[model samples]
Target: FGLTRDIYETDYYRRGGRSFLPIRWMAPESLRDGRFDTLSDVWSFGVLLWEIATLAEQPYQGYGNEEVVHYVRYGNITLERPPNCPEILHKLMRACWTFSPGDRISFRSIVDELVPYENEDFRLNAYYHTQPHSQQETVLTDSNSDEKDLLLVDDNASEQQ
Candidate 1:
């Protein structure tokens, strides 16, 4: 979401100083023109997922806000998959971070992709620790695997080309 400053009793304007804003979470369009909507939130969610995969490491480490904006807008420096992150989850994060707002995956699609792993015993920590390397490799290699299918949905059905 773009920063807002209260302008009237119940009205707000999307303009503010950038001192506290974390530019790493901002979408390129938002950075360029202060335009934002749900797609911007999707981009931030991708960064949050990256943070989770990296055990909460700071994103765009050592980069200032202006530098991050320039890199993202012009250089297209998206967050890379953290070490040991599951391929399926990293794919979902990439979907969320598509450069075009209309091309980003929907929140509904994200939940659908995650639903298969929602059982009580399906803790991410436990799964990461207990799953054998061979099994992980098999899942990654199988094109028809559930995880791959989960990442392959057509989420742009409503957007015109």
Candidate 2:
């Protein structure tokens, strides 16, 4: 649940293999004893996709590291997208979660799915830009020191989680 470099070398599913902590936002392969390509990264992104679709709650909030590990290993969590989330996006999210390493969907396919969504997002954005709201939206652009503090805070918060 927190950021740790320690390898989760025991497979929670009894799959008779070593496990590893998902490195930050990367996949299991990032901590494995080999090269981790973009595919593995996609797998990790799938978890983030779940988080975003669920209104920013963590992928498995309130769970300890061991429980999160078990949940991912055994496919226990059924990620439910928010009501307004499109089905195509949900399918793409599921595609990223395909278990077999070789069977996972390609990044190109992901882009194909995302292109339409991005276009829709763009249209919505353009519409919003044309309208006048009561107050101007404020964006906090982080400075280098702010970024460092953010990382530190994230590290601390993750530990607490």
Candidate 3:
């Protein structure tokens, strides 16, 4: 049997409700209502990114599930950028956590963003290149203009997907 089947057959699965799951992984809308879809998965992906970036640190470490749910629903609290997380990756995670489902970035865009990091050699060189003050300044200056264009492009691409 597949992993899903094995997990589903467990006693924990037989016990209904989300008591066993972490509230940090749940999207705000999913908590408020029963609605779940790709957008919800996107939110979960953002939480997963946080976990990976923090070396699997439990999210909202000191908060209870109810407290987290309230904070997420009313205060819009999201995972803070981990100490060593790449700015681009953190940006992608933020995009995934957009409050409105329609505004959240698509998984395809997430894959696109991660494609460059997949090549270890390129990543090393790129990391070094990006570290220069001049390069950082250039990126900051260009990002605002690029963001407008990217939003339009991402909207079109997400619609097609």
lDDT top scorer: 1
| TM-score versus the correct structure, for each prediction | 0.61, 0.51, 0.61
Candidate 3 residue runs with Cα over 4 Å from true position? 1-21, 120-161
Task: Evaluate all candidate structures by whole-model CA lDDT and list the values in order.
Answer: 0.74, 0.60, 0.73
Please give the lDDT score for candidate 3.
0.73
Residue pairs clashing, model 1: none
Q: Name the top TM-score candidate.
A: 1
Q: What order do you get sorting by TM-score, best first?
A: 1, 3, 2
Model 3 clash pairs are none
Model 3, 26-133: lDDT tens digits are 788877775789998999999899989999887777766667878876646888899989999899989998988888899898889888767767766776645654
Worst 10 residues of 1 by lDDT: 6-15
lDDT measured at residue 60 in model 1 versus the true structure, 0 to 100: 78
Counting clashing residue pairs in each candidate, in order, gives 0, 2, 0
Cα TM-score of candidate 2: 0.51
